[model samples]
Target: MNTTPLRLLIHGASGRMGQALQRLGSEADSGCDVVAAVSRKVDARVLEGIPQFAASELHGVPEFDVAIDFSLPQAFDAILGLCVARRVALVSGTTGLSDAQKAALDAASVLIPLSWASNFSLGVAVLHTLVERAAQALPGWDCDIVEAHHTRKLDAPSGTALTLGEAAQAGGAAPHYASLRAGDIVGEHLVQFTGMGERIELVHRASNRDIFARGALHAARRLHGRAPGRYRVADLL
Candidate 1:
């Protein structure tokens, strides 16, 4: 195993996942360094010692090996452009991106090593695989997906839910989706396959945001030396 620590950059550093990454990535055993943090406004009190810069200040910031973005979609283009320009690997978990933004990400992936996932939780990735297999086994079953997140979560049918639905579709099932936004729920997803008299439900619940933060860091480590392309959590799994 390589003992050298990876130099890391955290985008949207004031956000929940960004703060989680900062806390975890600061551990001595984490095998990475948080070199800089980017946000719309640099909050010195929240992000002390570590260099904090506004998004507009990114061009003046020095390069880091990899960048983990948990920012909003509106900040994505700037982050993507900066990463590509600096040839930095990117690990992003931002959701609810516009189609044009996604296309741009695809285009940028050709130039920098980029790994983006809706949910970075390892269990969620496993849930996706299981959902796929279950969908394949239960032919002609009605598939419905339900996902719940905190009320502040901007996207309906959380990106992970959409990814789960896609997995079901890939396994020859057409799935309908429903989304719920309630108070402070970390995250929860259920994929149900209903047949004649029985039903199968595969569920994943996240009680904390740290799972995603850890997973994104793991992805950044894996992406460090990777070639330019779009990568997924499944690849890490």
Candidate 2:
């Protein structure tokens, strides 16, 4: 394992998640050095000790091992292009991407390593594995995913829930979804597999969004020096 800290470029640096990642990346034990930050707009050329660049100025940023993106869909393509152009890895958690944008990721993965996920909590990654296994074992089971999040979250059957549904579908189980938005819940997902006289429920809950940033940082460290390919959050573990 490389003991040297991995060099990271934070995309969407002005957002809450971006701020959290910068904070953690600044820690002595984070195993990461945030060499640069990129956002859709730039105010200060530098902030909190890291160099900053606007989306339009992406090509001007210093080289980095991996780019961790937590921005909106509008800012996704530029950073992805920057990483591919630089031949580096990329980790993104931006949701609500268009089909063409996702297809672009598939095409780009052939040249550089990349992992895009709806949720980056390590626990959620593990739940993906467990849900797939349960779906496989319970051959004829009915799969249902129930997810709840803060009322401010607009999308029903969030990106995470849909991703989990995809996992279940991959295991030969048809999946359904139920979404609830209430209070200030951080995030919750329950994948249930029901068979004759029994049921299995795989669950993961997030109390804070920091887990996503931490997981992306972990992924950045793991993706360094790997062959070009598309990877999942579970793959790093």
Candidate 3:
């Protein structure tokens, strides 16, 4: 294993996933350093000694190996521009981007290594793979995806849920989605295939937010020093 630590920048350093990354990435075994962080409003207390800057202030920040973003979609363009300018790799988990915004990512991917995914949990990735196989084997079944998250989660049918639905579609099944927002549910996704008196369900539940934080860190390690290209969490798996 390469022991050289990766220099890291976080785009949404004040948010849930961002804080999680800061906590977990600080460990000596994580093989990375939280050199800097970016957010709309800089919060020194939350960020501790790590430097925090606003999106517009990124021009003055030092270069880092890779950036992990969990901020709003609106911040993506700015982050992409910064990453491209610095020749930095990027990993983004921001969801609900418009087609044009996604196009911007595609354009940037050509200049630097980038990985984008809706969910970073390894279990969720496995669940997606399993859903594809089950849907392929049960052609006659009706499929449905139900996902639940904390009430503060902005996007409905969490991006992971949609990805699961896409996997089902790829396997020749049309799936409907249901989204639920309740108190403090870390995350839960269930894909059900129902047929005549028989049903199969593939489920993944996240009890803590650290799973995503760890996954993003893993992707950042894979993205470091890689050639320019668009990548996905599935690729890491």
Candidate 4:
């Protein structure tokens, strides 16, 4: 690692993950100093000490070595354009991206290293790995995924659950996704593998959103010295 602390710019500074990142950045040993925070309409108190900006104000701003974004899907393209143009590394945790958005990221990677994942929780990545292994191990076993998120979340199946399902389907038959939304449930995923005599269940639960923020921090550290490319939480872990 470099001797000096990395300067970081945070996007989506008003969202849940962004708030957790703010707390994480304030703590000791975070390895990055938050120099700037961007949000569409952030509460002034939320960014009380940090320099803040509107999304449109990014142009010609002093560049940071890394930019971590938990912004929504709608803002992804703009963020990517800004990061790549600035030659800054990126860690985006936004979900619900369309196929075209992914292709855009792929194009952006040619200019700077960029890591993107639906969920940044390390546990979720482990769950995905386990699901992939189980799906491969039990060929004939039936597969189903049940996922729960906060009621306010608009996307179905949650990105983590879909990631798990995709991993579960890797090198095997297709798996199905079942989504559930209720009051402020942080997250939950259960992947069941069924056979004639027995069933195996893989479960991952999140008590709070901080896990993802921490994971994103870890990813930022891991991705710091790499070349231009995309990465996932598993790669960082």
Runs in model 2 deviating more than 4 A are 1-3, 195-198
lDDT of 2 by residue, 147-180 (tens): 9998877678899999999889889899999999
Q: Write the per-residue lDDT of candidate 1 for residues 202-223, one digit (tens) a residue.
A: 9999999999999999999988
lDDT of 4 by residue, 1-237 (tens): 366777778888888888789789766688878888888864562354678877777664466888899988988787889888878899998889999998999999888998999888877877777888888889988998888888888888788778877897784947788998899998888998889999998888899888889888888878887898887778887
Question: Which of the two candidates, 1 or 2, achieves a greater lDDT against the reference?
Answer: 1
Who wins the lDDT comparison?
A: 1
- The C-alpha TM-scores of every prediction are 0.96, 0.89, 0.95, 0.94
TM-score-better candidate, 1 vs 4: 1
Model 4 residue 10 distance off true place after TM-score fit, in angstroms? 1.3
Model 3 has a clash total of 0
**On residues 1-237, what C-alpha lDDT tens digit does candidate 3 reach at each position?**
778789899888888998898888888899998888888887462356677888778777777899999999888888888899989899999998889998989999899999989999888888888999999999979999999999999999888898899999999999999999999999999999999998988889999999999999999998888899998787875
**Residue 102 CA displacement from its true place in model 2, Å:** 1.8
Which prediction has more favorable TM-score, 2 or 4? 4
Candidate 4: worst-modelled 10 consecutive residues by lDDT? 41-50
